[model samples]
Target chain A: MAFDYDKYLRPGKLPHIWCPGCGHGIAMKGLIRAIDACGLEKNNTAIVSGIGCASRLPGYVDFNTLHTAHGRAAAFATGVKMAKPEMNVIVVGGDGDGTAIGGNHFIHACRRNIDMTYVIFNNSIYGMTGGQFSPCTPTGAKASTTVYGNPDPTFDISKLAIGAGATFVARTTAFHATQIDKLIAEGIKHKGMAVIEVLDDCPTTYGRRNKFRSVVDMMKRLKDIAVPVAAASKMTAEQLEGKVLTGVLYKEEKPEYTQQYAKVIAKAQGA
Target chain B: MSSPRVEVIERYCKGCSICVEFCPTKVLEMDAFLVKVAKPEACIACMQCELRCPDFAIKVFKD
Candidate 1:
């Protein structure tokens, strides 16, 4: 059977705003497949996103969604989880929104170990904002703001999540379309904060500026630079150079924030 | 089950050619700016075109 994506998508939302060959669509499809695999109730799931190209994803999906202010998806998602405590909260945003503008909120949410999933589409540049160099942009990458190439170092988003206390951290590229959904589904099933960083492509903004001739070139770049975690472990450091590790990098059991808070409430009520 | 039917929803397709280019089998091709099924008999149901398609234009139906 052909996967009927129309079931999860809303009416008249087809022809999304993303440009041709933008990897966001592939990532979104992965997300839809993951959501379907999880069998989450449509009404019980809340998809939250901050302002960016990737942020627009929630609008197309049939779910309780919130398109919040710039870099505030994590903060808003945290509130949603604290209030309902039962609803599944998922946050999606681009690298700039997650790591630059919303960096503090993102880290804090991870630190709190909230029972939510955050999927960061790290395309390396702020595509919606016209090719601004984001925190995940590789050094010497060209962006509209960085005509001479970016001088700043990049953030390893999965590592950042792990350091900030997220219980699950995974990474995959758009080229690994199937892996994206598997990781996301695992994150949704996890009890604590789970972050999945998907390395995507921005053909119109990031690609054109960075000398990637076409979308295929960008996709090829993602494919070439990715090394699976199992294979990466056996590769020498020199062989692993310039390649990012894909698959679940870190996972652990932790006391989820919601459960911890519930205990506090019970104790306060003398139960 | 027979070889899967590969369909391209033309309206939703942005003519990116990612699916046509990435199909493991030579089952797809470009028709002007849009994509079409060039060699349906060659399709192996790998679903790579459908999965990697940024446009959600491709679908493979297995019997």
Candidate 2:
């Protein structure tokens, strides 16, 4: 059976505003499939996003979407979760939006272990804002701002999330379509905060500057560098240097922040 | 028929050819503007085209 992409998307938003070969579409589809697989009610699900190309995703999806300020998707999502704990809130943003500008909020959200899912569309560079070098841009990669090369190292988003106390963390590229969907579903089902880093492609800005022959070439590159987490376990550190470990990298059951806060309130009120 | 039906939303497809490249069974081909089902019988219902399409322009269904 074919999954109805149109049903979840807003009418007339078809032929999305993304470039011809952008990988954000694949990530969006994975998210929609996850939401469907989780049996989440559209009315009760809230999709929040910060400013960026990936942030534009909320506008296309049919749900209670909040296109919040730049780099503040997690902050807005945090408020939403507290105000309506029953609603499922998911925050979406790009590498620059999430890690660069919203870095503090992101780590705090993970540290709190709030019941929400954060999907970072890490395309290496900031695609929407004219392809500037972002925190996740690999060292020596070229961007509009880094014409010579990006001097700094890239941040491992999944590892950073785990370090910040995210209970569930996973990484997958747009090339691994099925894995993206499966990991997203599992992340949403997890009781505590979950972070799913999607290494998406931006052919227009990032690819052009980075010298990827085409979007297809970039996709092949992503597929080539990805090693399943299980297989990666046996490989030596040297062998896994540049490879991405895709799958649920870290997950542990813990007391969710909102639920714990509610318990505190209940005790104070004696209710 | 047990064969699959491949539909390409012409308005959405920008002729990126990602779908064509990923379709393992060679069931799809690029037209002047968009993708089309060239060999529906060989589709195998794999849905690689639908999943790999960056534009969400293609859909494969067993019909």
Could you tell me every candidate's TM-score relative to the true structure? 0.97, 0.97
Candidate 1 has a TM-score of: 0.97
- Clashes per candidate, residues 3 or more apart or on different chains: 0, 0
Candidate 2: TM-score, chain B only? 0.87
Per-candidate Cα lDDT values, in order, are 0.93, 0.91
Candidate that scores best on lDDT:
1
Task: Put down candidate 2 lDDT per residue, A129-230, tens digits, no spaces.
Answer: 898999999999999998999999889899899999999999999999988889999999999999999998989998888788988899999999999999
Model 2, residue A156: distance off in Å is 0.8
TM-score of chain A of each: 0.99, 0.98
Could you give candidate 1's per-residue lDDT for residues A35-142 as a string of tens digits? 999999999999999999999999999999999999999999999999999999999999999999999999999999999999999999889878888999899989
**Pick by DockQ: which candidate is best?**
2
Q: In model 1, what is the error at residue A201, expressed in angstroms?
A: 0.5
Off by over 4 Å in 1: none
